[model samples]
Target: MNTAQLKQEIIEYSKKIGIDKIGFTTADPFIEMKNRLIRQQELQYQSGFEEKDIEKRVNPALLLDEPRSIIAIALAYPSKMTNRTISKKGERRGIFCRASWGIDYHHILRDRLHLLEEFIKEKVPHAKCKSMVDTGELVDRAVAERAGIGWSGKNCSIITPEFGSYVYLGEMITTIPFEPDTPMEDRCGTCNKCVDACPTGALVQGGQLDSNRCIAFLTQTKGFLPDEFREKLGNRIYGCDSCQTACPVNKGMDFHFHEEMEPDPEIVKPLLRSLLQISNREFKEKFGPLSGSWRGKKPIQRNAIIALTHFKDETAVDELIQVMNSDSRPVIRGTAAWALGKIGGEAANLALEKAQQVEKDEEVLNEIDKGLSFFCKDEVGQ
Candidate 1:
């Protein structure tokens, strides 16, 4: 069994199964990535959703016994929604970034990896393999970068020459020793557009990211969004694509390679007001398949309130007032109160004043005061 022939077979099989790109690398410890991860830890820049054990993250040996090679796969997703939803004056909408536009990539990637693993086992009966998507211990970008799948972009995304940065990455560690692919060179020369376009300045520099300020991480947080990022959130209900959108290589890189990765106009860009009162069951039914829903509806609801304020959608004032007064979750209620303040008007002020009388939660009260301060500013202006 020629290893090179086997690698070619795997590559061909990957194409048949719809894996847009595939590459291989030695399962050696990622020395440079470990140092960067340490720096990220010292800087408090990690998103905290990653595997906590740094050793497992950098060393493939810790994950699998005598791992020989790692296979990295990429699937291109649509950058622009083909069937777009209209976000008009009265009908305001919130977005789930392009990454979350379609069926969750985790499921799709895992399925592809599983198929690849089965094919390898058929060829090599003694082969042992382990696969993971974004949530895996190994850094998907690092593996992809080493495996020649793509270069690590300034936006902290894997930017392939064929698909730009609009690709979902996953990897598999295998015992079969396969020839490694040449890693791509750093092609993002003198490009700082991704850093400039970050809404919260999350991209600290070319390849470094401060996840604390990243809207993608911030939106998944269960607590109330910080005051600084509220206005920057725009209409994004989950994740942010500013950095990717700003990349020169990603310009006009709209790929509809996978049907499952296509965005449903209504689901990804849903009406802002509808999310305020969505039931748990309804939220699950509507967004459970999307990766953004993994954090549950609380953050989505909180972000939706902020989005309403971003637009100053007067139509949502009634909905925000109702949420401020009636919602069970303090974070949601408090966010709604703050949104009412940001979207200041007589109805919003009246609602905040009314909430102060009966709202027992201390945090919600503080948010109510914040909301009232906007009216105070308006008064002083007058």
Candidate 2:
């Protein structure tokens, strides 16, 4: 078959496999993206990259490891799934971003790509193919845009007219050359709601994302969170969608009905009280199949405590005290102390004294004292 016919067939088969959009490109623009990465590294924005690897990202030959056409695919995720309201009560809710709410997209898309690869190999016996779904060094977004899938929005997400920014991207790199699609026009004009709505100002100018202040990265990081960013984290225990939520293009899209992507019932709008009680075994069981489980439960449980502190729900004092006194995780204990201080009252003060008496971690002890001061009266009663 001719390149045009092959491209058309691939697009048709991709749609049949449940992908929403498909397009093709030469994979040459990856060089420019590599240059951009080099600049980012030079500017000290990225760490642990040798200059050679950065150059490789821009070379199409290096991306595919062979000269071939590229196929870019996009899958629409339900927008309604992202709007679930989590409760501050002790019940605890799991908050999975709509993109990651259901089964892992990597497996789904890779399976389809394998089918396509088999089809191509049958047609051209000597053809070679490789596929990736956000797991490679190549810039998928740049290739997707070049292939006419959609334009990059101001929030650094691809925006398709039919699905807005609620789409997941994947690609197949093949030795068989195919006709490429025409690039799409930019639809986001003069709208800065996404930038304005970012709680940590992660979206600097236009499409640039500062990973340092990104709540998504912060929540996913494995260690103790910096205090400054914790306060701004709000109630998010997983990924933060404030930028996507504020996009005008995504407005009015119902994401709640996508049952496949629903948050695990145990974690759906979980209460701070119950989140504090998650054992390591329970943490593995509850979040193991989900994306946020990569960092284990400590970071998420700690985030829950921060959110509870922000809520200032005095009713959570007992749970916070329990966490502060008995939780083995220092980050959780420290955050619990902070939350108790925020919810200061007679009960909280009493808990703080008890926590301080037995706390071995100096950091946690300091947090207990801080909580105590908020509730304890001065001798002068001023």
Candidate 3:
């Protein structure tokens, strides 16, 4: 059979295996993407999680030998939960963003790509294929955009006409010289909703992001979150969805095609207090499957403290006091101290005063001081 027949079979087989969308493109160097990446690095706009080598990221040949074509795939995730958990007066909850809703997309996309690799190998015994998901060197969005999967939206997410911006992208570089699909035209004309909606103004301009100020990036950090972004975090425990949620295109786009992509409401939106003292094993057992938990329980726990502060749930003060006084990690302890101050009460103030006497870490002491300052401000106002 010809390469065209093989390509057709791949497309048909992709549908059978739950690949929501597939497109093909030549394995040419992404010239425009390279320039943009260089600019992002120059401006310090890139998330440090990306591969450091710019050449390797934009060049398919660097990743695969004699690469002739690339296949891009997208799997749509649910924007709305079916059995959504709601937060109430005493029982406030923290949220993991929709991207982290279900089982980690990294695993799900890899399973699909592995199947595709096997199918291609059977057709052409000597065919070469290299696949990667979000963690890959080749930018998944760039490959997807080039393969006509979707147009890159202003929010820096691929926006498909059918699925909006709610899709997880993956790609495979293959030696087969299949015909490339025409890229979709940019449909985000005159829409700045995503940019305007960003809580920390991380979306500096259309298609450009300053990851340092991004809530999504901030939530994953394992430190005392900067004071500026802390309040902006609201109740987000892992990732922020302000920009995506504000996109007019993504409105009402909720697909539950893959069962693995379905979110467990309890895990994604757990009670804020419960996370404060969760054991390491308990956290892993509950959240390890979700991509957001990759940073371990520290960041999530820290964010949960901030979330408790966001709600000003006085009930959480006791737990926050425990975390502030006894947590092993200084970052978590310091953040809990800061949160305790934010949720000021007699108990929280007494805890902070006691912590100041014994806390050895200078950073934690500073946070304890900052927490006490809130009470000072409150007293002066009264």
Candidate 2 lDDT by residue in tens digits, 1-382: 5877777777777666666788888856565666667666666655232234665555667656666788888877776634455464544344656666665667667776888788778778887777887756667788888889889888888888877888778888788878778999997888889999989888877787777778887887756677679789877788888888899888876544334455554554456566779788987776676656677887888888777767777777888888787787777787788778777777877777877887898877777776677665542466
Residue 43, model 1, lDDT? 95
State every prediction's TM-score relative to the real structure: 0.99, 0.88, 0.99
List residue ranges in candidate 1 displaced over 4 A: none
User: Please, what are the lDDT tens digits per residue for candidate 1 over residues 229-283?
Assistant: 9999999999999998889999889999888988899999999999999999999
Supply every candidate's count of residue pairs whose N, Cα or C atoms clash at under 3 angstroms.
Answer: 0, 17, 0
Cand. 1 TM to true fold: 0.99
Q: Tell me the spans in candidate 3 whose CA falls farther than 4 Å from its real position.
A: none
Model 2 / residue 144 / CA error / Å: 1.4
- Given candidate 1, what's the lDDT at residue 97? 92
lDDT of each: 0.94, 0.73, 0.93
Cα distance off (Å), candidate 1, residue 308: 0.3
Give lDDT for model 2. 0.73
Which 10-residue window in model 2 sums to the lowest lDDT? 43-52
By the lDDT metric, which is better: model 2 or model 3?
3
